[model samples]
Target chain A: MLITRVKKKDAILSLCKGKTLLIACFGCKEVHFEEKEYQALKEDLKTSNLNISGEIQLDYLCNDDYTNKRFELHKKEIDEAETIIIFSCGVGVQTFAGLIPGKTVLSGCDTYVLPGFSGFTPSSHDCEQCGECMLGFTVGICPVTACSKGLLNGQCGGAKKGKCEVSKNKDCGWERIYNRMTVLKKDDLTLKKMIRVRNYNK
Target chain B: MHFTELTKMGKFVITSELGPPKGFHIEKALHEAELVWPHVHAINVTDNQSSVMRLSGLAMCKVLKDKNIEPVFQVTCRDRNRLALQSDILSAALFGIDNLLLLTGDHTTLGDHKDAKPVFDLDSVSLAYMVKHLEEGKDLAGNALDGEPPKFCKGAVVSPCAEPLEPQLFKMEKKIKAGIQFFQTQAVYEADKFEKFMKRVKEFGVPVYVGIVVLKSVGMARFMNENVAGINVPDNIIEELKKDKEKTKSGQTGIEISARLIKELKPLCQGVHLMPLGWDDKVPEILKLSGIIAEKG
Candidate 1:
């Protein structure tokens, strides 16, 4: 699932200062999309100078076929409005803009994405998609994404107290790899082998 | 001694860089190579260094080889795909070039030819691994090589004074794992920090040739500080350069400073990789002043 957050309310207000139509994606496929946060922004827009001509709660706005059908169903309401604000990620906003030419399609949300797992549910884990995957060798903990230094072999000397030397807040990925490997009875998963460079194009 | 030979002999190896001319100024490139060849163990040929197009580094290495000067062929990942990179390894070997330095080159947009597409099919680490594979007589796809494997003294670049130093350290480990035998650091001015960095790097057990870029003027130092990513020039060095108004005096002072840095960093590092920044002829003076070589009678 893709992650997203609302654009600044003040900027959205100015973009929709005139009569406008609000297309909100209620069915955002994030592990946890702040539905109430969007509701709060809608409340604030109600108090602003922008007159809401119509509102459509969209599901899977990034789906071009579904979006096309929805737009056709609400053609009268959309054409009547001066500006259209799509409350979703960049993909949804781009889809609306590309599908409806000459329409004022403004993005109400900014895309905050990580490399998403295909299966549903939000995860803090992100795979940089560096083509080559070394998860099996490192006991499933990704050093490429988790480690501050992105080291493939042993950890740099900077790791202290199982925390990253660069990013103090983050856990050292190598430490986790070590601990996990110990648990799995694989004491030497990372031993005696030189890990090659990660290729991101994969 | 050659670079690897000197380092292995524990003789505090010294290497210097030589930028091939941007145009087909073959004579000028040869002249520059001849100028710095004697003072250092080996001359590193730049691969269109700083993202500016120039004569290819492999060609320059062949040039230096013909002159009986050992060359470290610097290869960048910015211009070539994996196939080209592997092929270049064979070509460098066939040309009798043994030293190889791999780098993730500067973006093409940083160069004059912005429109040219950058083929980053392999980064520095990957390229280093590919070279290792070539040495092992196998291609990246695990295919058998046609003949004898290429032999090389592999090296890579590092920036020890990087603001967040861990990333650089991390990549250094990766380079080592990829079979890199040596390293050349970016311009380093923080002597204390570099000492600490080298102390940590010693555990990796590879020779690092500390990079000393001669800063000839306050403007040049400031330009590097602002424009270059990992190079950090201390204010005192900048103020020292600013003290001298005469170009000759400042240039001489720059050489002294570079020599001093080399002398100070000698204990912590295995060698010095001098980057003279167009002042290629001053290399001998720097070596003499740094006590790496003796003054003439």
Candidate 2:
């Protein structure tokens, strides 16, 4: 489950000058939302003289059909609102914006990563789906997700003592790749082969 | 006039870095450049080195060129997009500056301007590729140049002392494939490790210059050990610096240490890139002490 933090009250208040519709997605199963903080936000908004046209809290806001159905049910309230504030992951905000065109859809929350298991399953590795997979050559360590900079060419000169400079707790992805390649006795061959430059268009 | 020609003739090339000042007063900076002129073959004008805002490297290169000193134009992907980078490349060419050092600059967060947006539109490898395309009279979009396309002697950076060194080697090979003519490595403090690194780098057939950064004091050494990436200043060097109880003379000790490293590293690589880190006046001393050049009369 993606970890999210609510945007500052003042910043959220600024985007919601007119009558605003609020859609807060608690996310799918196993996701955690700070109910106290969210409730405090609604109370603060009310105290700040914000016109709350409608409030809808639901799960799976990224699901287009589910979100569209929810919108239909709240059509009257949605129609009256001048701004739509979605408190969810980036994907959910984008999905809402995509469904309702020409509307000021603003994100009320920011998404952050929690190291492992970014997808549905509880796995050690996560793929960013960068289109071109270097996992085969890298012996399964995904550099795009693992490296803080998402450097594709190789390791930047930022890793120190097997740990990443950006995040001290994290292992240097290229160091892991190097160690794995050595274990498999593929380092020599890997060194000879030119690493393909990342196709940014992909 | 390419310094690469010296490498072709098997001369042990010597280069140094010149950080553009934060403000417009460039008299001291120019004097610093002249101080090392008798010692170094070329000077690399840093492009916001360490992510700190400074005078434009291209502008400084032009200034250095006016003094007849060969300048290596250092460009980073941290500040500009493809359009601005291409424009600047052509502009550098227009000024008759041909030597280029392409780098994926340190992140913007590391600099004085922490809130600045970093634009890594083209990395060093891709920038080298773009330069190759530009040399062929084409821009990145295949647009033809109005005049003679710029030809540059392009160089790139590598971290030879990186832990699990194969990834750096992999990238180095890719850079060479991307038409990078030479390489200047990240600060190296260990001789044995660099010797091993050079053994692999030699197969690539590109001139690899060992970078020697002067460690100013015990604090600086410890700071780099804890903070800087890929630079591991061994405890022995720190102990050596600490032995110089006169903190004022630490600069002298730092010069001694750098000269010693350059002396040890001279045989292992094609050249030495001295990064004195504001100790510009000490470069001639370091060069003379390392036996790179004779003592001036």
Candidate 3:
């Protein structure tokens, strides 16, 4: 999932209290880091006694060409700030780090690789990005991400009422996988553990 | 007899699990499988159940096969990549191991090998697809086999009682599309809920074997409730076990409870898969209580 949570808000403010540049990509809407979170962050920064040089909402900071274009447009602000703070996913943060060598860069959010629904909003469903897609066979469920145990073959001994043993808040991923297969009239495809080994690169 | 034959003859299928030992000590597991004979249509030799290192499901399946025991060999995506999986599948078929159960194995974090890199090369769904490809005489890459392709009585898993049930429902449908022949579900304690879920499952008309793990005690049920993912033991069952532990012998109570569950589930599903969870000997007794004959005199 893209930047699910932000960390070290005070640490960010302390470092960029004066003459600091802020670059954010709260895009990707629902799944990625949202703009409302950054808006709240801006409100917090106003009371922190910081000399804000300028803020750049780098559109799709993960893209190199677009980032460069934005960089060219914000050269004056870049020159004025003493430090750079990023509030996008790790990819966007890395892009800025590579773009600005001399400047001290700070990450505003921590990115999680586990997928969330819709690339932008955090939906209950997730994808493991295991390369081989099983949703076609599993009735659109992703066991790699859904099951806490990630059991490829069957349900664990610990599952209770179709909820996962590890976390009560989360539904048992396998339970959902089975029910989905049943509804789709594909339960026969599940008799044998079909796992032939996944090609991670795929 | 093969599970297919048993089900075809209208015999309510009964299957149980045999966990391979942590080391290569296969004697105990082999012995256990033999002892469970006649009662169960086949024995599911687990592949590293609970992510704990054990003899591979295929190796144990071979061991069981040598003894003429039908083994449901388990395969998981947590350890191997595609080539290794394909090679092993062929090997299992060569050894006459026909039954298989695919899984997205538990995360390596839950096992003793937590530090080892986990290889979730495929989820259970993709694995099911791979099996279908093999059955069609072609590899996942579309390469046709030189001779007759291997045949297997494929079994997939389902956890019926999980909440927010839509995703599991969808995945079950996909598995059918992928060509799974049968389904053995996760541990289920509540028959009413399972029946309700089956009401929806009936839409597909698949043979679904309800999973039943013998509950030993209140602590065991509570631990499962607290630690495991994707299964919940209702409080009433827990309360029954608690009373059993506090006031009577838990072993007898567990048998009664599990047998009661099986009896209730008999008419609702195709079969029952009993996972003793190390309580292998109790399986026969549990079966007996549920009116399941252990042997044909």
Please tell me which predicted candidate would have the highest lDDT against the true structure. Answer: 2
Model 1: CA > 4 A from native: A1-202, B247-250, B294-297
Alpha-carbon runs more than 4 Å astray in model 2: A1-141, A183-202, B247-250, B294-297
Compute the DockQ of candidate 3: 0.16
Winner by DockQ: 2
Model 2 chain A: weakest 10-residue lDDT segment is A121-130
Clashes of each: 2, 0, 76
Give per-residue lDDT, candidate 1, residue A36. Answer: 82
lDDT of 1 by residue, A80-138 (tens): 98678877655555556556654555766644445656423223455443434444355
Docking class of 2: acceptable
| Per-residue alpha-carbon lDDT of candidate 2 for residues A66-126, written as tens digits (9 for 90 to 100) | 7889879888877788777877665566567656654556667655545566636223444
Residue B38, model 1: Cα distance from true site in angstroms: 1.5
Clashing residue pairs found in predicted model 1: A31-A122, A131-A202
Candidate 2 residue B41 Cα shift, in angstroms, is 0.8
Question: How does residue B190 of candidate 1 score in lDDT?
Answer: 86
- TM-score per model for chain B alone? 0.96, 0.97, 0.95
Report lDDT (CA) for all predictions: 0.73, 0.79, 0.71
